[model samples]
Target chain A: MTLRKRIIACLDVTDGRVVKGTRFVDLVDAGDPVELAARYADEGADEITILDIGATRDARPALLDLIGRAATALDVPLSVGGGVRSIADAAAFLDAGADKVAVNSAALRDPTLVELLADRLGSQSVVVAIDAARSAPRVWRVRAVAATEETGREAVAWAREAVERGAGELLVTSIDRDGTRSGYDLELTAAIAASVRVPVVASGGAGSVDHVAEVLEAGAAAALLASTLHFDILRIGSLKRALADRGLSVRLPRPAPSAQQVAAWLG
Target chain B: MIAVVDFGSGNTRSVLRALAAVGAEACLVTSPAGIRAAERLVLPGVGAAPSAVEELMARGLWEPVRRWGADGRPLLGLCLGAQLLLDGSDEGDTPGLGLIAGRCRAFPSVADGGPRQVPHIGWNEVRTDSGAFDAYFVHGYWLDADPAAVTGWTDVDGFRFPSLVRSGSMTGTQFHPEKSGPTGRALLSAFAAGALDARVEAATWS
Candidate 1:
């Protein structure tokens, strides 16, 4: 009856298309957000995060059509973020079939927004996403506006504050390791996870299944992956199997066939 | 027809979709009349207990829902909906419908001084008398129910609490079966079918 560590597939979308970048810049197309999300769900992703990376900068709302499509195609919970500045915006995403609404810059601007969303939509549906970069050795500062502005607030401190303000979960992304594929900033993740009593989802560097396992072992309740999953560098099924083999509890659709086993079957 | 109660809390679309996936004709019902008219009832909620109670009262659904339970109609509550069936909750000093004999309490801090998070959000294994299966959970409070009413239990950070409870025609689950993949779908399908058949048998006998 123990809680299983989750593997969350993140889809950073712009203009309704999935995109990926290094350090949150140099955006490149990944694929259709809905298709990728459905595929990940089928492959046993515990949850899916569809972040509308362009919403705030473009002064527009999240792609409701795309979110609705993704929701219809998958059974697992869908958490949508980006451009959620007001209750109405969050409502729009939830109405569009998102199970949870993630707020980042807006939450940094006014922490009460977290409480407001939690008040109206239930705390379980409110996730506060904090993008942080190492400010000093072992010190991480919160970044905003797409990791362009350093808010001067320490990451762990902000995480504690956000949860107190009614954030049910914290999506902590390490800006330094993000897209670098160097693996998650375990120190930062563990620190934030320890500081707060809410579940923490570790985002930003995921290079391999070992990295996913490492983060979960370090204290992350869940791990979010982008580049490796988007580019087919690793399959969700295999990663889950690898984690299970490592004795970390992970939910896989079924036992994934090994390459050698597939070869034998084909022969 | 299965009616998923909506009182301005939680997502009913996913619950509806999950029920549909299980071949149940589920729809959202937001009024007292709607609750009374449905063949079966599902109270699905995920917000603060006080607010949820306020909305149900405001919509004049408070009495109807209680009556439905009193009449021995098939009723299933999920998450906050399950919590609402209790006498009250510590989350909001809110008085619930009192359909089930329990009060919701916050999860205690980790005993070992290790970091055990509140709002235990993730997939957790649920142990029912039948067997074990995984379900999605996202809550800070766990129900303190009468042991006689408990049907299932889940362990979190060494804390054992009621994850499922049943009384008469009422059943409640602390986890979101709609979000638990195939296992969830099967549970929902079985619940709907069993409830419907029970209703049919009651009708025939009466």
Candidate 2:
């Protein structure tokens, strides 16, 4: 009866296809972005995050089309990120059926964008994505521009500022562990979660059910999965059941009615 | 036609989309005249209570919407729209439409010695008398009212609140039926099919 912790499927779409890579390179085709999104939604993903890794200016139309198609198929919340630099950019995604827009590099460049987006679209629709990497001993720093540049800002501090600027949720991605299958950065996620009042979605390094459960124990309101799900290493229903068996609340799909029952009901 | 009130809120598109998916013929109505013209009305809103109320007032939809519900016409409120049907809200100390005798209150930031985030996002179950169904939710404020007013209840970190309510011809759901997949679709389809209307009529005559 409690609020279920979210299991979000991340679709790192590049050049109109879903791709997964280790630490944001050596990209390999996962599936068609829209098809994978629809499949994950059917598999009971609580939410879906579509990050257009190839979101150049010219790629906007294709990304929008993909998002529109995916949104049409999804019944759960869908969040889109990558190249969202302005209010108009966020609006475009919403118009294309995205429930929330995740902004990382743009919000770091100008935090006011978060405020603007919150003002126009409500704070609940704004998701500030923080890509963090280990910079020094026991320190994680925020990275921008698809995790290619360092902002010199501490991850926890940036998270607080993002919330203050009106980000309803934080999508904290561990660049060091993304696709590494080691596990989420527990220390980094817990730090950010403790520093902010908004919900934090822990992303990257989800290789097993325990990894996912561990991050949630560290205080992430949601766990974002990509490669494990895209490559069919894990199923959403079984993962949810495992999480539930550990006493964590999750939305389990209802059993479908039998064909005979369906016939009787239709009659 | 069913008029989906559009006050420039973010959820209008989703509401319209869901209604269309349910095969409900709906249109975005902003003016009071449009509100009056519709056979049925849907008030779908997001954001703060004050601003949402202001948007309704700005479009002259505030009074007409109140009257539409008062006339026992079929009306559906979604999320913030549902909150606005109450007398007032703790969010911004805002006044509501006074159609329902209740208030909107914020969810506790801390419950059971653990931090509970505001703006409870994602999917949760809405338990009715018949059964429980998973539905999507995203809000910090919840309706504080008599249990008799509630048709469905949901729990968030030990804080139980009304998730679905019905008063006369008007129905309100705290969860987003438009985004809640099949369960939500069934609710919307039931609403479109005059399921609530039939019950309201039965009560009125009885």
Candidate 3:
């Protein structure tokens, strides 16, 4: 069977609570991160990515607790990101049950951090999250600190470097399209996807099923959804079905097995 | 109790939680003594094969684990653990347990399907004779074993490889069942029930 394109549900958590806002401002409480993560898994999310947007030295304990609870509730892979700076910080998240840790600002500040993370935690456990804003019609520049600062690094060049430094996957988010409900910055996503040999997960600006389908068609291996999923704007089950209808290889949710069926499988 | 072997690496907690979710009485077995006390063993690992083997040896579990498999008790190897059940691996030029007759090979950078990623990461379908179930997988190398020993297969990039394999009472899966949702839970429950062991016994009798 062909590899199924993944659908990742992202939770932007702050102060131990799930929150979302337009363009990283005017935050509003969505619900408990733990409950929402479990619900998404039940809805057939291939993976769950939790970004501690409010990640601080003081908030480390709360974030780890939240991640541990979410990880226990999930059967699928759990990826944690945001404010992960040092090897110790990443190790703490992994110990807290995060299957993977995503690095952004710290990675850009010190590219060797990716190598260190890969050496310690395996490359598969290291994800390089790149937030890019359109600088020209065909050019995208990397932005850091939740898209608050420009890094002057070309997005595609950084993507290649990250992969060379041992990033197993790239989480590319489009700052220009973020919270716009327009669609993913296909040009930016496709560029990064084409440049990197690893899997590219397109994030930001997922308003409709077609938008997601468009990104996948653009060569992304996965699509990360936040507002679209958190606010009930779109449902994962039906979205997967729609993608399947479109002939994209997607993992459809399976029925919960009964005790008898489990026995028979073993037999 | 089923002992989930822990060698200071790997996602042992997730394995424990998955076993608990499936109602399996399981615990982390870090030493030979713990392995001796358990009725069955589950070797779950991630990361590089050499490091895992090193950690297993460092923890004094190498000989005991190999002896356990040689004795033909139920053994389930997950991901890197499954790779370790083979004779050797291309990763780090590492030597494996040799419980199965094969070697772990890395995926080609370019195949008939054109350029593909090294670490095949994501959810993919594991096709068994009975049916197919999508399981989460993350690995850079795959097991190349005798086809008769292969029970389940998965396609990645441009190649088809063993996702699940069996040899007598031992079983191994390239995919992570602990993270594969319902399908994984069912497999764990079956292991706990000793249903897989029964199959091997029946085959031998037949």
Candidate 4:
């Protein structure tokens, strides 16, 4: 049976804090990544991706620890990206128990890095990160890991090529719409999904349940969201029901309330 | 205590919050020692199966958790955590904990034709006896399980995939309970209530 799409929550952790913003500006602090991850987990996030954002080995170790702690405490898949440049970094994250290590700027500098990673970590362990945004002629270019470097690459082709070279999945984000809450760049997402053979996780913009509906309809295998979930504006149940109403096939968890959900349970 | 096994994946805090939200005395522990100390265990995991299993091995939680599940403690695996409950997984060639019998792997993300993507993400309906319930999914691979063993299923891309599997005391779901809204909370609450076997009212999709 074909697996239903997933709703992933992106936690941008900087110094152990969950930091998020649109276009990487007007950032706000939600809480500790661990705390925030837990909150989302309770809220029913399908998957949690922790992008360290900062590029450092120390941070890598800490992130791995976080991953280990998360793996033990969580019941969902945790994807760790950011600041990863070498096999060592990927290994570290995996050693801490990450499902996949996402590579962006590092792979762009050396397209072969994706292949190398696939060889070392296996393609399933390597996730190629594509931060896509429109450039001249409405062309899509990938923003590097930390938005530092620009690559002369096409996102749709990049997705196809990465999978061709053994990359397992594509985690593509729209830099323009990141944190915009306007919605996902379904146009770009759909375009890339068409070009890729592997699973493409549409990231960058997700403001509401409607945005999620738009992207899933646009053909994304999954949609990645940041910030939207933290505020409780867009919830998993509502989104799932919304998608179901639109005829998407998803699994609904039993809506059993915890004792604490009852005010009287506090006593 | 309903134990949340800590393997350092992501959102340990979040799962605990979920457990707390459900009014389960959720305790986060990394070692099998703590796991053995609990009445029930929630083996929540994310990231890679092999690595997660590796860490579980490292912490010496593998055997005990298996034994715990064997001894009638209700074990719930979520997402990758759920995937690891199987016999084998395609991600990283890792052998699952075998608490539940099945091979877990990623299928072709999209059907052979059209422009669909992989890692099927987002929310959809979970069909049940009462009616269809809305929930979320976020993974490339699903449980390739025997139809009888699959307690829950979802249709995607014209294919039916197992979404939840319950074998004895072991219950697992590919969806995340913490991220799911009211319905998800209800599901977890039911599990906590020890009523996972019963189907609830047909939820109106938002």
Q: Kindly report which residue stretches of model 2 are placed more than 4 angstroms away from their true locations once superposed.
A: A255-267, B108-115, B200-206
Candidate 4 C-alpha lDDT tens digits along A1-267: 355677788888887788887797777887777777766666666678888876577665667778877755555567898877788888778767566789888888888888888888767668888888888554788777566467778788788888888788788888888888888888788888887667788987788778898898888877888788877778876787788788875544454445333111111
Which numbered prediction scores highest in lDDT against the true structure?
Answer: 3
Of candidates 4 and 1, the better by DockQ:
1
Off by over 4 Å in 1: A56-62, A254-267, B90-93, B109-115, B195-206
Ranking by DockQ: 3, 2, 1, 4
Model 3 reproduces a share of the real contacts of 0.57
Residue pairs with backbone atoms closer than 3 Å in model 3 (clashes): none
Model 4 misplaced regions, further than 4 Å: A119-122, A230-237, A250-267, B1-206
Model 4: per-residue Cα lDDT over B78-106, one tens digit each? 88888887888988888877777778866
- Per-residue CA lDDT of candidate 2, range A171-207, in tens? 9999999999899999999988988878899999999
Please name the candidate that would achieve the greatest TM-score relative to the true structure: 3
DockQ of each: 0.25, 0.32, 0.57, 0.19
lDDT of prediction 1: 0.84
- Those runs of model 3 whose alpha carbons end farther than 4 Å from true positions after fitting are A258-267, B111-115, B199-206
- Lowest summed lDDT across 10 adjacent residues in model 2 chain A is found at A258-267
Task: Give the Cα lDDT of each candidate.
Answer: 0.84, 0.86, 0.89, 0.73
Tens-digit per-residue lDDT, A221-266, candidate 3: 9999998998899999999999999999999998766555544432
DockQ of 3: 0.57
Error of 4 at A119 (Å): 4.1
**Among all candidates shown, the one with the greatest DockQ:** 3
**Ten contiguous residues minimizing lDDT sum, candidate 1 chain B:** B194-203
